[model samples]
Target: MNINDIKMVGIDQNTPIEIRERVSFGKEIKKALLKFKETYNAEVVILSTCHRSEIYVYSENIALKTIKDFFIEYFKVTEDELGQYLYILTGVDAVKHIFRVACGLESMVVGEDQILGQVKNAISISQENFASGKILNKLFRDAITLGKKVRTETGIKDLALSISYIAVKFISDEFKDLNDKKAFVIGTGEMGQIAIKNLISKGTKVYVSNRTHSKAVDLKKIIPEIEVVPYDDKYVQIARSDIVISATDAPHYTIDYEKFIKVYKGKKICMVDIALPRDIDPKIGEIEGVSIYTLDDLKKTADENKKKRIGFINVIEKIIESAVNNFVNWFKTLAIEPQIKNINKFADVISEIEFERVINKLSNIDERDKKNIEIALKRVAKKMSDLMIKHIKNDIINKKYEEVAIDFIDENGGNI
Candidate 1:
């Protein structure tokens, strides 16, 4: 397939969290991948994270509108609901977008390292479901390599900024110091763990909880100083804490408005919900003496990080550009290889026919002479095949006869 067949349609940090939440695959991502595969018969990879819900596909016939329609039907949302939030990218633009995303250049917290792993996980999930094919597999593999290269060659990840780090940093801004504060963190996943560790680094008395008690116990084992609260008893610990951060992959809200109100003591508290589906209900933000933050709120800290690290952005962009070019060059060969093979096959056929016609007239020739003539004809065919391939490649690189070169190959050689 051509590079233009590589397409991506989704919403990112630009979309409001309310709308973003509606489109997130969340725990249903694998199911979504299977559905896309069944419906469109395309290579699909869904990258659903706290900041984005991107569906990437590689197919020759699936139109952008088809994916848009599938998104609307599957998510059960109308065009009005999506409302200018979705982005559509294809060809080189799609390649550049993914590379940027993997390198953390497109993240809300620019150059945040977590997105690299998230991208890897998205592709891994797609592979596990058997939804990804050669094109998407190679695209994602290149993206991951570029991600690692950017981090290694540049100082983009030097600050080690992440959504979790920024969420805690937001709260840290409100308080003079975290050393005297107690934090109750829900979920022990990557984001949850990052939040917990960042809080501990600030010398905050951290109480961790997870739906799986063993995970929370494991976390506490890693940091013996931190306290572990039972998942059901989280509300008790949350009430006692000055700060509460919920960052779980649960589909439903972990701290809904109804349940949180029961344990509400009217004491001033700050809650941060960093999960994509959102662990804390938005309505809880309306409570008296309560302040809540979601992924959107971290934009402020992200902006500050961007300003401090603006210089690294240029370096990152150069690296992304180089990576994009390399991937595109490799991708071009997918389309060209079949044409080259056809030309070589055509050459072989022509050489055999001409050799037979001439050999018939040279019946008196020795077996050695026949063999030498056969070798000469084969060498001539190989030379002609190599010459045509070189010219076609040059034309593709120049973009001068790229369209016509394929047509030429199709007409002169493909059928033969």
Candidate 2:
């Protein structure tokens, strides 16, 4: 019944990109959950995104060592490597962290809307795999509700500063105008779509490419002006474009330095890599005419956007507090319900035994008198049960239900 039994272990934007990339589970989330459960016998939910990887667990006994071992083996990280990057949170802090994450307060791009869906998706995947229990299910459901509440109630989401949007903004700031810019976007995922939209909005001619050509073609259908370049010819488009935004979930680098350097025609280009495993090679930034920006580089604009929305942060915090308090209160009730049931059962058992003893002792009395005596005794027992339950309910409201229930049960009889 201790709320502190809930625990979370993971890393976020605070860690270096190299560590983040290594720790990130990406598409292997379901497999990871199964491994975690099989290894630790605990209910778990994992949230992995471009900027963060988090695991939430509910268990009777949490073994940090076991959890750490799972991460070490799964991510192929050494014990020391895991220790440096992993952050552990427990009890109410774990709950608060989840709510904050769902609200996008913990994002690199603060108030970004993508994380909310990511959080929901994490819980959904956990549920689909039966890796979530009552505690995690309730926690995630409330967190999602709180996320929606924060967005609808505040202006925090007014100018949503997503990674994709930040990349485009970074590019926009560098150039006087994007009207004449030829931009090539790699990968047609969510981030790619967002980048394309922002680029098109700024009147830039966009060339889109994805590993799956159909996806790029689909994006072209949405924005008729965009040209869907074949995946193989992406470098040719990259060589020609003034701006490049790469946001793909590819395991390896989509744009390699060796190949790109060979194809370079000395045209100055601004490149932004927004993918997790990183879509572009770091060495490409060394090229004379190429200025490459990774997700870390987008922090400057993200920070500026964060500063603009700092005033509304207090409002969101209050909303999260209220939501968390509500969830904790409900969880407390869940903890106390079992004790309440036990108390009621004890009352019934005691009442029946006492009534039987009195009736047996007065066996010589008339049948009518016996009936009257039994009715009176039953009333007294019912009143006593009602009073005890009233006190228990009061203790629950005051958040002293556990301590008070223990004392009451001990005072009555250890058996109860």
Candidate 3:
């Protein structure tokens, strides 16, 4: 987009996860960019992640209208239906928001490291249709740098416990020592595998189960010391497991309460449900001696970490504020520099032509006096030139001469 002016619309966290997932697709970015170009004189980039689906547009109305239209079409929701969940920010605020997101400061888990990678990947994919313009490129570069700063300069980085680790931690807290505690991580999804790795790190006996037997077996092969349980026999594994972390991409619950109660009756079970659809049944949490935690529980734990991480975040915010201000100032100057260069180039030509014109008239004068006259005339010209330069460049920066500025540059080689 134009970099200076930005508009955004989104299916944010306030929207239900089901609705967000329904509209979510890998093709959303490409489709949004293509469709946006039709109705708006602007550039569009779609930022779609599990928690949020937002479109940042350089065009004025397109940013809000185009994205809302897409939401209606993509999610099949009316303006009245989804408007409350969406937010739009313009100009520098939008840029600052993106930087915060890229830095992981706005994540579900505060100070997460994965979001930086996700932001970079999304930026790359969007570039297939849109572009990471100088503005966005510099914004992302600063974001990555800020992420590194947060990691090194703050204890917040260490405090980052992903949903995966949190799930395993919930289970581990129940046991006096996980050294002998048995656990089963169902599914080979990123969350499940991460939970397993974290569990194994805690000295728990780990087993894996997945619909794809190869996936479970592959995980076991990679770990070597782990076990691969049959997907159908998950309840059997659950019965033996002191802790269970279930995170599957399945359309339905993997462990319904009826099946779970049949195998795990009265067993001291610590279950961590990592799936959004919920791999474990709601009733399971009510079972006596059964401790079950879902994404909700993870948020609570994340909230605690966030409180501790807050100390560093205020400092990070200061850095972000200073960095963003400095970036914008430098960025604004970059836009104005070309015009300055243009005016100066023109001045240099006038100075050379006028100097040559006056040189012949001063030939009869003493050498020192002739030089003094030349310098005085050029100095007067330069001062006048400087005043006009500032006025013209300011007009460009303020978009007063935006249309004619490019034409003026093209006509006079100002772009060079």
> Of models 2 and 3, which has the larger TM-score?
2
Give per-residue CA lDDT, model 3, range 1-416, as digits (tens): 24446655676656875566666654567666666666564556667765678776654345455556765776676677565676777677887887778667887666666667766666676566654455555666676677777667875755656878667666756786899889988889778867776677568889888999998887765466589898889899899988888889888889988988888768788888889888888898898988888899897877788577767788878877876776665566565566567767776777777877887765566778767866877787689768876666666656687657656755664642
Question: Could you tell me which 10 consecutive residues in candidate 1 have the lowest summed lDDT?
Answer: 153-162
**Which candidate's lDDT is highest?**
1
Number of clashing residue pairs in every model?
Answer: 0, 0, 0
The full ranking of all candidates by lDDT, starting with the best, is: 1, 2, 3
Supply candidate 1's per-residue lDDT for 254. Answer: 92
What value does the lDDT take at residue 95 in candidate 3? 74
Task: Predict model 2's lDDT versus the native.
Answer: 0.82
**lDDT of each prediction vs. the true structure?**
0.86, 0.82, 0.72
* Candidate 1 vs candidate 3, TM-score winner: 1
Q: Rank the candidates by TM-score, best first.
A: 1, 2, 3
Winner on lDDT between 1 and 2 is 1
